[model samples]
Target chain A: MENKMGYNASFAEEVFRNVDSGDEIKMCMNCGVCAASCPLREHMDYPPRQIFSLIRAGKREEVLGSQSIMLCTSCYTCVVKCPRSIPVMDVMHGLAHYALKKGYTPRIEAARFGKEFWNQVYRRGRVDERDLAQRAYFAGGFWEGVKKILEFADVGIKLVLHRRMKLIPEKKIKGISTLRKMLDKAEMLDKGRSVQ
Target chain B: MADVQTTNQSILVVGGGMSGITSALEAAEAGYDVVLVEKNPYLGGRVAQLYQYFPKLCPPNCGLEINFRRMRQNSKIRFFTMAEVANISGSEGNYNVTIKLSPRYVNDKCTCCGKCSDACEAEIDNTFNFGMDKIKAAYLPHEFAFPMRYVIDPSIVETEDGKKCQEVCEYGAIELDMAESTFDLNVGAVVWAAGWNPYEAEKIDYYGFGEYPNVITNVMMERMASPNGPTQGKILRPSDGKEVKNIAFIQCAGSRDENHLPYCSGICCLASMKQATYVRERHPDCDISIFFIDIRALDRLEDFYTKVQEDEKIQFIKSKIANISEDEATGNLLLEGENTRTGEQLRMTFDMAVLATGMVPNKIDIAGAPEVAADEYGFVINDPEKAGIYGAGCVRRPTDVASSVADATSSAFKAIQSIARR
Candidate 1:
């Protein structure tokens, strides 16, 4: 009797009503192809297939709170192989966007990197790998940052050896003012549309 | 001439497999003259090659035996083995069919004697066993051959062993001079039961069906399990005849994806489940694992899935096998895929692996037989203009034995109805 809590449509309905392309998951057949094809599936609490299942089951807290939605690498393998062509990658990105919009902090490693990467890209035209890594490493407080920097030092040294990382910070791209204006305008439009 | 031909109310059922046999019997027993044509020198199509069928693990031969009996009892049914519909022309009620009969070389005059096969030294691949075994140059298709006749391979017609086979046969059943013949028949309707062929596993390439000896198909597994098959009912690896204790079944080998067959071949899931029985029955301690994206055991058939699942030995891994490579040292197959449930990247070894390859309509090879139109996958779709021609069983869509039988029976009624109108 306890297992008879059948799928609740309200959560899925609420998602469809609010979030963009959230209803695209209605095409999911739970074939597990998406999850199997996903390279980062091991790090996910719920694979793409199970995420859809949870969505159907009206496990709102579990679906939004899961770190799985934030783990998509956008490889498009699942999108290519899905029998139903569910646009699984898009749904994952959409879920992550909606989760952040709902003020639910994912606090996963990927989200941390993603936030740092986004902030750098928004401030400058592009990101400097050294500065981005520094910000990401130190975001966990001083001792943890020191440990993280030490852990990644080998790869950092390799990059420096290969000349992939410059000694100083990267300079701003040409037409920074124009780029900032466009970004601000796009952001204003995006926020206004989402609010509506 | 056309007016006289239009008066014939006979129906021709192509491909003497389950659908064709059922269609012929249903139409013939209902008092319409029926012609059952087969490409091979046998009546039972793919069903006869199977060790057992689904839902009920009954021997496929028993049902085929009874069908042949019913066919023998019915005088209205006239069947030709080693026959093909070379061409079909004219409209719904007045179709002129040209049939080409390939010489079996060995005539039906003699009894089922082993002398011809014994004397023949040349060997040929026995397709009935899915090339798992070899047959003598002169051989019966299988022990359960309906006509109980032998066929001489055309390749060895002028060879020394072929002459020796002809010389040794006491009854002069071997006819080396037998030339192929073509004949025509007038029929009111045609049942395109020209069934399906297994999607070639070599085309999948990654599974290495042709490259790796231990990698076989589900059909080959069925033949291996058959009591009269290559290994005589023993589940052994084709490479070295070692007992298969641990085996893997890869489902959806070429189906339900855009890369290969784009449609979900309905029977592969259940078919693989039944194939697992072959391994389990052979070795009680055999470890059976099936890698699949989804198990589509539908309706009441879920009972069989449940029964097999509850066996405690058969494990279902939720993943589509990504690739297969040979463990060159041991000659075992290494199956690689991520277990979606546990998120485990599996690189498992097995004594044997059976790919549940999908079914492709046989019409792909034999196209342009007038009035027969095919889908992209070569499944013959119903031609409304040529209303007399109806696609039965797998020709119309992917079907299981039960569905194919039901389709054959219903298609029989459709043919009869068309002829009655004529």
Candidate 2:
């Protein structure tokens, strides 16, 4: 490996100011408890501990491009086990949201799934499982979408028989517009929080 | 004589560990009258339990033996084992102290013969070995227990087992009805050398100290390596008594963390490194890996770190082990962590694991003495202006044997100065 350049403070300063609970990473002594306790650590390209180290080392691209931040299942094991009591789960979620706002889709599948989930709630004020499933499965293309739908055809039949899904197009909930306004307001506030 | 009449000039040393021994001997050798009180029946507190010291790997008894000899020949020193300071009053020059002495149940007339232990039926956990084994109720503290006498367990003193031990004593050493007593001594200054207790490893929970048969603390590891340990000089797994071929030493088990001991115990890094050699020497093929946040072998001890680092079989991994689990069937331990230096996720198995736990200073409550301060972590803070009481050794900070001796010598000198100034 080549000799790394000296630590740059600008990226860390940005993370501290904009990312939620990002300032708490300053307390990390690199003990690796966060990574060890993370249930999703094996799937992550970089573990939570290394993510924090990258943030400190000013590897902006490596940190924002890491799938580790988006892979958090919010298990809370890292949060509970951290010797420094760092809010690890919150920070990981915060990073995932931040990456999307910065136009960095580190993992497109997770980003697309999150967007579909949000769109379903915003449009109907409640999720229509059939429609949400269709959107998610078809996001790849026609053939891939058909393959996924066929793979889950049995489960879909089981849901309709169980009355969990309705064949008729469901109407919007009673207060759909009010819920959308509240969500929009919340999004505006979240955007303002990062700017300040 | 043109001298102001000050009250008592004798000094009182309140613990009989390495520090207390040094303080007592240094003052007594300087011709100042000294009284040393210890809570245990024997004088050597924690060091006597060590297999060997660090750096040179010299046996602790080498230094302890010299101090014991100096203590024995010095006529100015008077000592009491199984005693505590109940109360202290007055100022720097003339302080009245009440010493509470617990009954050993065996007096000076009884020589250490094996007859009492042979006859005694009651058995208790041998704490000297961290309860890894048991000893007869009527037993000596250890093989080289000072005062060279036996101690009848107070639990047995009331039962029929007590009568058997009493009757078996050909020397009339067992005193079944010995009562607790208190006495008063006026001393010019007091040296509070009350040492330390190992941080409770079980409290960490994730390390599975009490839950796993193969996980042991650093202090317990020292006893395990000793010739007189429960295994009799053999480093064997506690669950199966099998010889260990691989070991993992988890450093900073309870130190340098906000949840546990927040300060770095100055000696644990070196102590663990020293213990690594203990395993390597006995089982030359034993693979040892020490996982640590930092190898804090500061000062001259850094050279020892360099030497240990040079060993091909001993790996110095820079990571604090996150947790440990036991493989129940084989009685092996699984250590989990990510090696920070390499970013490699580690889930390694070993025959046994030693948790490098830190020290907790034994609380000192000197009633009616000057207001003694302690830091947030409960280490005693000695006020230089108040000359009556001095906190030395681990009571003041976590330190090794050599530093404790040096600190004790300074306490001894300050104690003499307090009297002379008076």
Candidate 3:
């Protein structure tokens, strides 16, 4: 009851100015279509609409620390259903990407899986399912990783038996050195994009 | 010899719906000759299709009958059904207009006896009921059709059944050899009452309108509630003949959105509210839920909205429906939205769903239609400088029935002024 009514305009401004596709949230009319359509809404600290509201309210910690922003699977259900044509999926993903760069760790496993998947993509030219699975499974440290692998052992065996994934420590594609150079150049260009 | 004569004094009213009919009557009653042209088999048009009107919730027959009586009493007004304005030449006080008439097959000799419909075997969709029911190949347009004529479907004209019906009729009303004819008239001014059509529901893919049999549009809901409707005013689910107790009315179905019509259709909020009465009248205990972004029960209609609000069974949820899915196992609809007030995420399943689809104006895109302008939302803009042309009713802008009538009379005055300019 004693709390002062205040909003963090700087945080909102930062989001609009720096976060990719963050400006799209300005179109949100608080219709709550995204929250209702979201299957993972019950598990979130705040729904997509609430996340947008929090950002506007200048509740910087609540917004940046929200698991809802990080939990977007990019299903595009919210994207198509938005009456204002707000790219809700892109905004959520952008917020998640921005949060990661700001040194905020996601509280949800889905976000970690995404980070591992992206890391594997960054290191290799293409994904080796085995390598990607190893990183994703081992993300929670040795004990949890072993439990996860054991849980998915049947599916892994089926994939292996079907030759869908090979046991080999997947060989690099041709011209790996050139690919690395191009990736590094892209990263450098991307990093310098916001500085100006 | 020094005096001048104005030869073209007649006003032409296009579209035979409420506005067009009112416009013709108003101008004609003002001592000017009027010609009314419609593209349907009957003159009543869309007003005749409605089960009831808003505010008072009076059946269209009450008003249309009075208009029909006025048309009958006034010899100054000449009306033609199944006709279109094929061409327009000249301007303002002196104009040459061409009218093309589609043959009704059943001539003026028709007594509206039950003989033709009984003798005929072929069935067709009864458009008056919005295709909710079927009519015979030879049938009356509606119970209150002006000119009181029966139209033989062009399909049955060459068949044996047509000849049989012709033979069975003692009045000799059926004319199998009638052909489409075109004629010209000199009119000083024209009133465009080209009305609106329901926004196409299929385009809102998430609603699953065509995909789900139980999901119906607001207009279809109107048809269903009519005594002459598909299930004879039972409010039954279209998938099965079971009565619907849990119904959801989704407002702003295709209006007020960037992806669809950008303008608020001006009447859907009230129309859906009126439709709630349609459900509540039959099933008093029915739990009718209306989901809307805002309750825009404007002006005097707000009284009726309050009356409906008093019903505990009829609850209002503040949310625009984004998607609707059918549960295949139950054959019921799963609607997802939110109660913004309660901040509660809504995942509701209903017996049937009514999508309150908004109005889309009928475009005056024909080759010879006058150069009347339309605003961004395709609503006709009546340019005052454009001499003889005027857009009335929903064609000018989306409006309710009461306003459409008032609009018709107002445009009639403009048309009269245009004709009297000489």
Candidate 3 local lDDT, B84-190, one digit each (tens): 88888787887887888888888888999869889999999987776777899998887777878888999899998899889989998888999988888888999
TM-score of 1: 0.82
TM-score of each: 0.82, 0.91, 0.91
By DockQ, the best candidate is 2
Model 3: docking quality category: medium
TM-score of the B chain in model 2? 0.96
Off by over 4 Å in 2: A1-7, A116-126, A135-148, A159-189, A192-196, B1-8, B89-91, B365-370, B385-387
User: Order the candidates by TM-score, highest first — what do you get?
Assistant: 2, 3, 1
Alpha-carbon runs more than 4 Å astray in model 1: A1-8, A14-21, A107-127, A135-151, A169-196, B1-7, B53-58, B70-75, B109-120, B158-180, B202-212, B249-273, B289-326, B331-349, B363-386, B400-403
| TM-score, candidate 3, first chain | 0.83
The weakest ten consecutive residues by lDDT in model 3 chain B span B1-10
Positional deviation of residue B68's Cα in model 2 after best superposition, in angstroms? 1.8
| Model 1 residue A168 distance off true place after TM-score fit, in angstroms | 3.6
Clashing pairs in 2: none
Give model 1's TM-score for chain A to 2 decimal places. Answer: 0.88
Go through the candidates in order and give each one's DockQ. 0.22, 0.66, 0.60
Worst 10 residues of 2 chain B by lDDT: B1-10
| C-alpha lDDT (0 to 100) for residue B335 of candidate 1 | 81
